[model samples]
Every structure is written in structure tokens, then in C-alpha cells.
Target: MSQRKVTMQVIADTVGVSKYVVSKTLNNKLGVSEATRQKILFTAKQLGYSKDGPSEGPSLPLETEIENGYILVVLPNYEYQSISYTYWGAVFQGISLHIQSKKAGMIVITSEMDLSKKVDVPNLIGIITVGTVDEQTLLALSTYNLPIVTLDHEARIIRADSIFMDNLGGIERMTDHLIGLGHKQLLFVGNIHYSQSFYERWIGFRNSLEKADIPLTQGNQKILTIPYDDNMEANLQQHFEELRIHSTDFPTAFVCANDHIARRMIVLLEQNGLACPTDISVTGFDSLEEDKHLSPALTTVQVLKQVMGRRAVDRLVWRAKNRDYPSEKILIVGDITFNESIDAPKKR
Candidate 1:
């Protein structure tokens, strides 16, 4: 007679551990200690254990018997008090929609919302982080060893998948749009070194100019040293200072990294008696509707925050099912929104 199949249960029986622990260890999921995982793996190898499941991937534990299905969602450090109904809010809505469909629970927290605060996460099957997070947070999460996915974050490790907007492509499209409007002497605002996304956007800006045979002068790239890590007012002051420093020789238009910065530049320019698209044209990325300060609508890239969130959740779900696959970096594209913020440069 043929030998009996080597199941996870047989390995568990040999290791004096639960079948669930062996399954978790094999799938690289949570709820298994490192030592136990190693022991189970060693024993399974020794026993020549071959999975009875389909070749596509390992089958998940029966849903009826295992009730532990919870996904932890981490957002960048930002207040959700007023932001709950805006861009981030839409993203959360998308995430919740997916989790609800999957019959799973979720625990949402921000970096600033729970720094050094330990909360109970009993059944964490996966983690999804939105936006760029600090290195400390990334280091802390790397220990979980569970499937993690990110949206709009460029700082992700080997275990995490990143789903973000095509910052470089969107920026290039916006820049070309400005050039089509007959504007030159363009300035790319915001500190490019702050984040990987920003650096890519700056590159797009430079590339667009080169493609159009336009010179990107040294003074055109304004590197504003802002305190974006924590303080808002300080960051605003610094951005204004960088713009003010070149007030005498202001470019015809400015392409900001994001909408928030672009809105602030418009306000500061107006305060100094320069009107947007009249004296200076300004374009931005991530067209959020919550900023009521933008009277003259920003000609920017419209990134679908909710779509990005949904895609990230989908990737996380895929990762949860397939443990052996390499991490993926999916780029979501944005559309250019034509608005009153940019126009042809006025006659000299």
C-alpha cells in the first residue's frame, strides 16, 4: 500500500503543537512563535511533508472554525478630526468596504495617534499603511512578519507591498499642460529630498522642461526647508520664506509637489500683491476638495485616493493568500484637471 500523506496535523502531532500553529508557520502568518515555527519547519522538512492543497497556493483555514480575521490599518500622522470627511476619509471608506465584504474586522490608527501606545490586536491577519511613515514606525512594524501593504508610501521594506500614484508621470503631464498654456520660466516648489515621491515629482518637472527645450535655471528649483514632520505653522513660514526670497525674480508659474503647498503659495503670492494665473500660475498635485482656501481652482493632478486605498487592500488580500510571492509595487495613475489656476503668461 502507498504511504499515508504527510499533513500539517501529522507534523503538529510530532512537534507536540497545534495544527493551527503549524499552518500559520508554513503560511508565514501571525499567531506562531519563532521557535515553534522553526521547529515545525524543520520537522516538516524531515518528514518530507507535501501539501495536499492545490498548486496555486495553500488553502486558508476554515472560516467557520477560525474566527481570527482582523486587519490593522495605519495612516500617516495627521489629525482625522477635520480630515475624516476628506481625502483620507475616502481612502478609509474604501478600506472598510473591502474589509466588510471579507467579513473581517479592522483596527485603524495613525502614527501620532498611538506613538508608544500599545493597544490590543488579537487577530491581526494583515496590515495596510497609508502615506509615507517615519523610519521608527517602519522598524516597529517589521517585527510582525505578517503581510503588509502601503498606499502612497515610498519607504517600504522587502515584506511590504506598496500601491501608490505615479507621481513622476502625473507631474510630467501637469508640467506639459502648463507649457502648452504658453508659460516658461517655471519653478518647481517643495523640498524634493523630503520623500521619494517628491523626488520623483521633481525629476518629472525637470524632464518635462528638458523635453520642451526649456532651461531649468538654478533659481527655478526652490528647496524650501520646512518642518513638515510635525509643525504646520513653522512649515508654512518656511515655505513662504523660500518664496519670498525670490519674490523679486518670481517665475511665470510654479509647479508644487502637492495641493496643500500650492494653495499656500497662492495665498502668500496674493498677500504680496501677485494674483494666480495673472501674475503667476500655480499647479499642484492631489486635488483635495477640503481646502476651501483655493478660490481659483488649482490646475493639478487628480489622484483617486479611494481607488488607491482599495487597490492596496486588494494587494494585501492577495499577499495574505500567497505568502511565497515577491512584494509588488503597483503604480496608480492620475488625471490632469484643467482649472482656472493656470493660463498663458501675460504679455511683457
Candidate 2:
């Protein structure tokens, strides 16, 4: 049986654009926008269009090609945000190991680097971004029109598949755990505006409080909305000092946004002559490596960091096969690890 031939007209019709636009896009001409060009190319690939005729095989960006070609991993260019950090390091390891297992090449570049100037476009099959990437950087990556999958982040200006942990659920669970310990007065500690994940964690905290019939007071809101900056540490200390002066208003426990913040809070509490799980209980998210060796382990949510990176690779491969499909946001669920940090509130 003979199959119908795929043509530029077919792709143009699928993409709702003029045949002239499709022609220009396929030839890599200058008229069309990067987004439009990518759409046209994806549509053409989906329809099996080629210079020779409708191809029996998938397009250039396919599983086979992805295995043979290199995948580029983009990370934020911050001193503390690199792969050396506990969370990001695990994620990068997952990505590196998965790529190695697939016999595929992988190149990592920081967002600080100019994509067009640094990247060898022809040899690359796809891109996987680890953390927050600015719109300008995203736009630069878009010029290549490759399939992009982001881990623990999303792009505001471009279309890409996103993979994130169950931020809301994890925190909500942790908060519920704290509430179960009879800690009625709980304070959330984190700059809610720090990142999307952090903001969601704050929401989760509020959700749990609401569920427990706890009022969302202005005092609680103030702690969650701390300004993120160099002075934040000082501000946090000042808040602690005030809490000490007004012991009646102090929370029974501190629910921090992440492990680092939780650890910092514990230190500050000790400095203020308060003891963790005695005077005040504490909880943290992101069950990091350091939690194992600490005198009193941190109670935190176990984010599947490596799984995020590995699944990102899996998603890129999926994208390669289904370029014409709608973008997807993938969420991986994580479990909470109860440790020495959380306890019943001491009677005043």
C-alpha cells in the first residue's frame, strides 16, 4: 500500500501559517520568529515531511540521534548554586550517570555563558536546564529550536517541559507532622519570594494551618514574607530577639523553607539561649547529606534530586520523539524524614 506524501502545505496547514512561512522556516530564512519557526519545524517533522519525500523514520531529533548526539545541561551562574552544592550536585550526578548509561554525550554550561557563542549547535540534540534561567538566556537557547526540559524550574518567556518536586505536598505533610506533635503556634521561616518552590512551600504551610483551624495571623505572615537579601540574616536575628522579649508571642516550632535555613535557625535559637525540640521545635525541607552527620538530624522532605536530573533526560528523549506534542510539567513526589529536630512543644 502506498502512503500519502507529506508536504510543506500540510505542515503550514497544521501550524495555521502560510505555506510561504513554512518554506522560509524550513530553509532557516529570516522572516519568521524563533517560536513560529520551531512550531513549523516540529509540525513538519510530525507529518514526516522531508526533501526527498515523507520519511518512514522519525525526524533528526529522535531517540537514536539523542543517544548519538550531546545533551546540554544549563545551570544558574551563582557561587552557591553550582553542582558542588548538596542538592544540585546530586541532581547533576543523576543527569551525568543517566547520560553515561545511554552512551550519550553531555555538556554543562552556566547561564552566565553566552549560548550561541559557546555552543556547537549541530552536535547538540537537546537542552536540560537545572535551575532558574533568565528570559534572555532562554530566548538565546530558543534560537536553536531544540527540545528543552527544565529541572526544578520553569521559564516565564519560553515553552519548555518542566520537572519539579511535589513542593506543596511535601511541605504540607511536614507541617501536618508538626501540628500532630501538638505544636499549635508554628512560625514559617523563609523568604517566600525566594523562588517558586519556596513560595509554594509557604502556601503549603498556610494550607496546613488552615486545615488545622489555625488563624493566619499577621505575625505569622510577617515571618514568611521576610525580605531575601544580605540583611535578611540580621532581620531574622532581630525578629528572634523580639520573640525572646515577648515570650507570649513566640511560636512553638519553626518551619523553615529548606535545610540550610532550618540549620541556620537552629544556630540562632541556641545563640539566643533557646534549645531545639526543648524550648522550640524545628523542621526543614530537602533531606540533604549533612543531615546524616549532624548531632541532631534535621527532619526534612527528601527531594528526589537525582531522579529529577535523570527524569529530565528521559523527558528530553520523549520530547525528541514527540516534538509536535504539547509541553508537559512533570512532578516527582518526595517523602518526609522525621528526625530529632521536631518534638512536642514544651509547656510554658
Candidate 3:
């Protein structure tokens, strides 16, 4: 059958208004009078005109079905070394499972790419962000007016919900454990970022030192502000060497920023003829499985990765459903898993 010829201009001419006004009124948009809206819609339907097809008129509701929309998942850096796949894997798995259960679609994007030039998709419901988000990216997300849920790092631009591991409490507990083992000279190795996790961990380390009456002088702490590049290891080694030289007393125990750094530091120490726990005790955060196989078995804090993942999905879903819900900041506490790497300080 030949298709019926129905155009928006024909409808506008019949309604005695411009095409723009007819388009707005037919779309049920604001700024048009109630009488005008009714008149435009009635005339368009009577003329067998439709936005989708003649058989399907523009009378379709503006509301989208929950299963029809897409959720954008933005990862800050696409580089392999910058992100922990294991952690992000669990988070994406949780989000994917929830999206599948709701019969929704997912669009994964990375901040490394220029997304502003890309075309925007309709029915974009919300965003699940993993890793750090800069101010520029946050601004882009805000323009969408969609709910946002961040994991790992919290951004100031987005007031949406955030879920992260309790870095302060976990580090404090780890420090206390070392103190209980009779370690007097303790050292904290950390990056010089002001990220929420980094700042919290630094605060926890300082608090633990103060509570134990241990002096937190410049000599005992090392802040390595090494840029993330191929020379990261060399830069860290230089800092390690400086700490070994300048400090009057070698720290009997060292609390490292994370498991990966701790493992590298352990290797560096051994190369310098220092045995872990025997000569110097070591501890790390994020109890990764690879650390377990280390000669001495690294002592570290076990972040509840799976639980954090599940909680993030729950919060996003809840916020998407209830717009009136208040923004939430959730910190999931982790456990201190003791291992052979940590022991009483060796007598000088």
C-alpha cells in the first residue's frame, strides 16, 4: 500500500501557527498554552500525521520504559596500569547484572576519549563512574541531569552518591596492629595525591601515631610524588634510597600505600640485603591474591570489593527510582589480615 503523505508543515499550516510552535505543541512541551496544545494535537491526529509513523501517532507518552534506556559507565583512564582490573571487574559485573535484570542497555565510555563531540543518545538514564573524575568530566556529566554513582574517588562537582572502602579506619587498624607488635619507629609510604582515599589514609596514619605518643617528625615519613610514567619504579627507588640514607634510624616497620607498592618495596629491600620482618617489617593495603604468594606473605587490609560493588549498584538503582532521596556517602570498612610479613621490631 502507498504510504499516506503527512508532514509537520501541513499540520502547522492547518493549526495557523509556525512549524516550530506546532512541533513544540505536538511534543507536549512547555511554553505552549493548553488550548494551543490541544488544538495542535487534535488537528495532527485528525490528519493522520505522526512523528514515528502514520500508523503510530505522536500521542505516545513522553515517559520511557525502564528496560528501554541506557546507562553509561565511565572509566577515568583507559590505561591498563592506571586501574586495577580485579576491582573494576567486580563493579562492572555488579552493574551489568543489575542492568540485565532490569532488561536495560549499557554504554561504556572512557574519559581518555573526547566524548563531547560524540552524539548523545536518547533515554540515557544514569551513569556509573569508576575511578577518578576531573572537574571537566564532572561538568559534562552534570549537563545530562542524570543520577551519578561513583566508586573509588569522590568528585566535588557531582553531589550524587559515592561508595568507597574505609581507607582511614582500615589504615588506622593496620597501624595499631604494628604498634601492638612493639614497633617503635614506623614509616608510612604514600603518594602525594589529595584524593579522598589518600587523604583519609594519611589522616589515619597520623592519628594512630599521635594516639601511641609516637613522634611524627619529617624524618619518619616519606611522601613520594612520583608521576605515573615508565620511570615510576626508578623514582620510587630514589626515594627509598634517600629514606635509607637521611633517616637517623631505619623504620622497623613500613606501612605502604597499597599491595602493589608494598610488593615492590619488599623486593627493593631484599635486593639491599634486608629480610622482611627479620630486619624490617612491612604491611600493605588491598590484600590482593598475588601478595599472598610472596615469600613472607604480605600483611594487608582486605577491602570488601564484592560488597562495595553490590552496594554501589543498590544505591544507583535506589536513587534512580526515588529522586527525593538524599545524597549518600558510604564507607565500607575492611578487615586487617595479619600475615608473616609483620613482626616485632628487631633489636638494633
Candidate 4:
């Protein structure tokens, strides 16, 4: 039979596979083994079948599947708008660049509508979750048994592929810097139990205090918490006001978890008639460029979010390629930015 006359049935018959398998392999629906996928594609090509009709065979975009299968970035309900939120945009940027380089298809799952409320993606290569998820979410995901890589989440119970910022080292260095500046009395801001990174940062803060012989006093840690709710500004103000009342005798400086907290600390402190680095010094993690807009500019830990994101993609693709490979975890460290927000404490 002429190569032009050969159909999917011919290729499936020759490869000893079903017609449906051959069709999915060609159209890229995803459940078949990679070896089987390759075999079907090879057979189909040899028999001269292409998406654009048989002729000289398939091109780069369509040798067998749709851009080498689908990789989904899930964030529960948050949409990726900009990298302004503690360097999340950088993470997205890194994922996009790497996936494009690999010539792969990528989709982000934020809500139920993306896949018609069905999380079942037969051809899913892997998943990279970018935000915090509850046990229910994790449980639902476990049912699929898809290759997963979690970013910025620190629930210790689940074992999966993950990448994390060096929260401990970064926060430790920031705390140590405050201590060195003659700021003996300092506070740790942000809720320590908010996420895994938050807890690690708290560990670093306590470690630094202990090393310096300073105590982690009862009221020194102010946990400013705001869940996924609409009244964040009001809640944040309330948290700060509650802290300010008890913070008078607390510290000369504050070690904030991330830039967002540091920025708020500065504003709230000013409202309470205190000035950063003058009355009280403050340092933060996640050296966001947008933070330059802050009056004194934030002194923070510089994070390589894009690098972390790229590393995650590397792990995800590798795991997908090697289905039986054990899960891997990657840790990325950061540097400190000694900006105007940190300085020697004011004289008593």
C-alpha cells in the first residue's frame, strides 16, 4: 500500500497496538507509556501519517503529541498577575521560559473552570503548585498521583517533590545584622506558623537570638496574620495596633519575614510615632525591587525566585521522563540587602 493511503489502522496493526492508542498518541491525549508513545509515533511516521496529512512526515511541534504533553502550574485560586508579590512573578517567568525552551505545553490551574472542574489530565506530565494548600487540596491531588512539585508550601506531612527558599539562613543573617547594629532588643514579625517558610524563618530568628544571648521574649514576636480574605488592610492595621501597645518596651529593631511585612511594619511604626532605623530598625526577606518605592526603602534578603522556579521545572521534567524516579527537593539560598531601613539604634 502507498504511504499516502496508509491510515492510523494500518500503523496500529503493524505496531500491534489498538487504533485508539495510535490515535491518542498521534493527537496527544496522554495515558500511554512513553515507550509505547515513541513506538506508535515511529510506526506512524514510517507509514507516513501526520497531523497535516502524510507527505514528508511530522515537524518539530507535532512529531507525536501536543508540545510534548501538558505541565500544569496550580495555585488553588490565585492568578499570576505580576512578580510583585514576594517574587512570585519571577517564579512564573522562570517556568514559562524553561517550558518554552523545552518546546513543551504549559497551563496554569487556578480555579475549577480551567479543565471543566475535572483535575484528571491523562497526558499530564507533572504539576507545580505555587501556593499554600489545605489537607483537602493535597488529598484531592494525591488521588491523581500525578508528579507534583510544591513551591512556598511547608506542610511537613506530605512527601513530594519541592523547592524552597533558604528561609533559615536568610532570616538568621538578617537577625544577626540587627544584633550587630547595637539593637539588642528586637522583634520577629509575621506569623511563624503561616507556612513552612515562615516556621523556618522563626527558627532562624530564635537561633540568632539564642546565639547572641538574647531571649526570645514572650511578646517580642508579633504574628500579623491575614488569610485569603477581603479585609486584609483592616486586619493588618488591627494586628499592628495590637502589637504596638505591647511593643513599647520590646525592641529597637524588627526582623520581618518578607518585604510585605517589613513595608507594613514601617508604615504602622510611623503611625505610632516611630521612625525606621531612627527610632526602630527593621530588616526583611525577599528583596523586592518594588520595595524601593517605600520611603526608607526596605533592607531585605534578595531572593532568586526565577532560579528557584527554573530548578523546579528541571526536577518536574526529569521526574516525568523517569516515572519511577524518587522525588527530589531543592533548596535555594538568598542574600541580604542592607538598605536604609536598617541602622544603629537611637541613643536612649
Candidate 5:
């Protein structure tokens, strides 16, 4: 008996791509997108395809372009996350600056591109992802066998180096600050399950309250976990109205998950005939610059977004050189910016 021959057709069929694509990809030429090229390469390797002959067995990409010194950066397709967004933009700027200093190339792409299209590039050293990427996308990336470092993301199913802010500690400090300012009746805003970071922030807030023996009543937890959508502002306003209608002991401060939600909370409080700080104080995380222009600057935690990007690049380079090392999670500590948004609870 003899073993079957492994050809481009076999790889193409296995990968569900056309033979032309397989040929272009195997030859390391243009005409195929990064995703398609990766798929074809993985399939060829799995099927034991050899360019020389069957006797030589499987042969993978030459990888000679590793000397090209290029790094691939992947971003999720969410509208709220991009290179231009305040937080993400700062992180990308850091990645860009560090890559330039190291004299390396960076290629950025979103997860929602047409996988069959053309995207020419040299063989990459590794991948660094920003924001929360879907598990399926991460699994697809793993096929390339390149080291991956994720910034502000943690995947349960895939093993990769991850870097994010000290979400838990940041929120805990903020909550302590509000409590010190004499705020007892407190509410936490933002969807707790929106992301791992958000959930950690909620936990930190709760931890501080528990230490002080501040009972978490049903009303305090009512609007904390509502998911954001097109009508988030309206929905938040409605919740506020309901709180006023039912209870005279309304919350005196709101610990928001992020700066955006904190700003929104301030506005909603004003519309509900409550003055921020004077009537109720609000605190937030991610001390974004856009919030500085607000009447009372948001009291929030300052996340090192750009520093997180630079650290992620450092981790990816380290992983590329030390492939066998265990994956590590790097946490960057954030500082609290004491601003005017928080004040002592008004006398009843």
C-alpha cells in the first residue's frame, strides 16, 4: 500500500478555498487576504503538503520574512472601538510610538473584514489585539502558531499574553474616596457584565462597601447592571424618575463604571432636578480628557491606555523570542484624579 499524494487541490478542498488562492498563499504572494492565507497555510501543514516532493514530507512557510520585523495588530469591529476613539486612540498611539522607536512595522486590521480579499504583507513576528475580540477570531489566529498578546482583553478558551489596567484597585480607591466624603447612600452605574474590566470595577466598588458594612439594598443595585443600547440615556432617565417617585432616601452618589457613564449620570441627575455634587456626587473610571470640559470635571480613575499598548508590544516581542514560556497577564496600575464631581452628602 502507498500513501496518497498531498497537492494544492487537497489543501484547497480541505480549507474550502479555491486552488488559485492556495497557490498564491503557499507561494507567499499577493491575491489573498491575511485570513485566507493563514487558513491555507494551516491546512497545507495539516495535510502534509510538500513543495519539493512527497519524500520530504511537510514543509511550512519559509518564515524568512521574520527578519522583516513586522507586527500585526488586530481590533474588534465594534463602532465604539477604533483608532480614533479617545481611549483606544491613545493606546494605539503608544503602540505606534514604541514600534517606531524599535524600527519595526505594524499592520492593523479589524476582525470583520472580507477574509477572501487581498492584503499583502511580510511574514509577521506575532499578533497584538486591542479590546475584546471574539473567541472564534482568536481561535482562527492561533492557527498561525504566532505569539499573541491581547490588550484590554482576556479570552477564556485561548491561551495568550494579556495586558489590562488595574480595574479592581482603581474602582476600590474611588469608592473609598466617595465614602470618605460622607456619602453613605450610593448607587453603582454601568452594565456589570459588559466586559471583564467592568465586572471587576463593580466588584471593587462592592468590596469597599462591604468593608464599611454599607448594606446594598435592592434600589441601589437596580440600575447598576442595565446593558447599554440606543436608548440608554432615556432608559437611565426613566430609572432615575422611578427612584425619585418611590423613595425619599435616594442615593447620594453614583460610582459609574467609566467616564462616559459618569458624564451621562451627571446630566440625568440635573434633568431630574438634582444638582451634581451639591445634591449628589458621582465618580467614574477611565479619566478621559473629553470629560474635562464638563461643568464639574469628573472624579475618575486615570487609566494608562497608552502605557498598556506599549507594554503589550513589549510582551509580544518577549513571547516571540521565548516561545516556550508560559503566557502572562500584565496589569497596569491606574491613579485616581480627585476632581470636583464628588462632594459630601447634603443634610437631610
Candidate 6:
């Protein structure tokens, strides 16, 4: 007895279906019921049909052509908010441009997805991440063994390439600018997360205050760890009132984490019958979109967001092509944009 050769028609006949149905089922295409699809697949396998063959399995190439390479871009947040859009837009543009120049493509992903669930995507040559990732997530990315480049967040200590803005320098510049305007009692407002950027900014704020011989007293500093959302206005207002009550004297200035916070603080101050630059001067980091349009244009440190984007892509691609490349920390400096929000401290 000789073994009968197995074919789609044979499988269809065995499963009591048309050859077209078996073909569609094997190709994993639409139109086949789940039960029918499973029956067709099981029968074909039992009959000694090679499931790994091109006709039976997925048709993706074993290795994507080098000329048509693809990379993955990851962002920290799911939605566009704050200055994230600006940074994301510039970084994505840089990655897309670079990929297009090399006749390749990029697939952008957000870390907002629950990592416990599985994701389906092609093998990526490299990754460009925009924010700090937790250790578990970092381990998962390391499992891929692909070169990653981070922007705005520190990537040096981790097993990845990085391009970050000189956040400490920017904060220092902003604080110094306030000091120059005769702001002795300055308040630094920001979250105290260990993420590199935030940590650096906090360090800069402390160092600037210490250099000026100003004590880091509770009355002169506040750290808000709460989420900025619908109730943010109320929360901030309450926090501000508490600060005012505690302080022996009102701080002459406030250095905020970013422009959004500064804007909110301004509004809250006005509501409480306090005015900026007259009652207290204010400065912000990450020159945001609405900064210039505010009643008093914000004085802020403009991070080289677009430049950071381009550098991140260039470095990631370079590392992807050559694995032995030494990782580097590229820090772009930001400049202060002076505006009406800052002025000499008011007379006591």
C-alpha cells in the first residue's frame, strides 16, 4: 500500500466541504466558521500535510528585506496632552523622515497598552521611546534584543541609546533668571518622581536655592503628586491657599515644572486676588503652545524638542546597523524666552 498525497481538495473531501473553503481556512481568511476552520486544519494535519509550508501557513517573509526595513516607535501616554504632542510630533517626523530616506517604514506604538496582554506585530529593527519606562517594561524590551533610543527621558544607565534635553541646565537657567529679577524666596513646584528629567529639575531647583543661601523650607516649596485632571483646579487652589497660610511671607516667585502648571497657578492666583509679576513672578519649563497667548506671556525655557527628536532617530538607526556601537547620552541645551510674567519682586 502506498501513502496517498494530501491536497486541499482531498482535505475538503474528507471534511465534507469545497476545496475553496479549505483554501480559505488554511489561508486564515474570512468566510469560514470557527468549527469548520478547526476541523479542516485538524484533518489536514492528521493526514500528514505540512502545516508550515507556504500554502498552509502565514505568508510573511522569514526576514524583511533590508531595503524595506521597519522600526517601532513608542510613546509613554495614550492620549495627546501637555507638551507631549509637540515632542511626539517632532520625534515621529524625524523617525518617519529617516525611515523614508532609507526606503523603510516605522510602526508607532504607545506604552498605554496593558503589557500583560499579548501584542501582534512584525519583528522591529529598532525602537524610539519618548518617556521613562518601568523596570518590568524595560526588561520586556530588553528581551527583544533590539537597540532602543529614548528622548526627554534618561536612557544612559539602561541598556539603550539616548538623547535627552539638559533639563537640569534649563531649570537652573530659569531659576537664575528669577533670582536675577530679585526673587529671593522662590518656590519650585513639581512631582518628585525618580524619572531622570523630574529628578534633574528638582536637583537644579535645590542647587539654585542653596547657591543663593536660601533654605529649602516647607513655606518655600511644594510637591504635588496628584493627577492633573477635572479636579485639578480645585486641588491646586487648595494647595495654594495652604502655602500662603503657612509661609511667613509670600514667595516672590514660583518656578513650575512646566507651562501648564504655571498657567493654572496664574489663574488660581488671580482668583485669590493675587497678581503675577506684581505679587509674585512666575517661570515655567517646556514652552507650551498656549504660553504666548496667556494674558501675560509665560517666561519659559524652550527645550530643543525637535532637535532631540532628530538626534534620537539618527542614533537609534546607527546602533541598529552596528550592534557594537557605544551608547551615548546626547543632551541638547534649552534657551530662556523672557516675557512679561517675570519682574522684580514687589516691595514688602
Say which candidate scores most in TM-score.
2
Per-model TM-score on C-alpha atoms: 0.71, 0.79, 0.74, 0.70, 0.76, 0.72
Best-fitting candidate, scored by lDDT: 2
Q: Where does candidate 6 clash, by residue pair?
A: none
Candidate 5 residue-wise lDDT at 62: 39
Worst 10 residues of 5 by lDDT: 58-67
Candidate 2 segments whose C-alpha is farther than 4 A from its true place: 1-63, 78-83, 116-118, 219-222, 226-233
lDDT by residue (tens digit), candidate 4, 74-101 = 7656555255555777788888788788
Error of 3 at 213 (Å): 1.6
Question: Which ranges in model 6 have alpha carbons more than 4 Å from their true place?
Answer: 1-67, 77-87, 112-123, 155-158, 217-227, 245-248
Q: Write the per-residue lDDT of candidate 5 for residues 132-184, one digit (tens) a residue.
A: 88887888777667889988888667779999899989988888888888888
Steric clash count of candidate 2:
0
Please give the RMSD to the true structure for each candidate, in Å: 9.4, 6.3, 13.7, 12.7, 12.3, 17.3
lDDT of 2 by residue, 198-309 (tens): 9889989889999999988665542545666667667788887766633866888899999888887888778788888788888888888876798578889999888988
lDDT sort, best first: 2, 5, 3, 1, 4, 6
Scanning candidate 6 in windows of ten residues, the lowest lDDT window is 53-62
Segments of candidate 1 deviating more than 4 angstroms: 1-68, 77-82, 110-123, 217-249, 292-294
RMSD (CA, angstroms), candidate 3: 13.7
> What is candidate 6's CA lDDT for residue 331?
82
Candidates 5 and 6 compared: the better one by lDDT is: 5
Worst 10 residues of 4 by lDDT: 57-66
Stretches of candidate 5 exceeding 4 Å from the true structure: 1-67, 78-83, 114-121, 217-223, 245-247
Q: Is candidate 1 or candidate 2 better by lDDT?
A: 2
Q: Regarding TM-score, does 2 or 3 come out ahead?
A: 2
Candidate 5, residue 218: how far the Cα is off, in Å: 4.1
Model 1 Cα lDDT, one tens digit per residue, 1-348? 656677889889999999888889999899887878878887776676766632232334333211347888887754431346576778777887777777788788777664455446776787888777887887677667778887777554446888878999999988888889897768787777777778889989888999998865564553344434446445665655655634555578889888877888788778767788888898888888776355898888998977877787778777877665557789988999888889898765
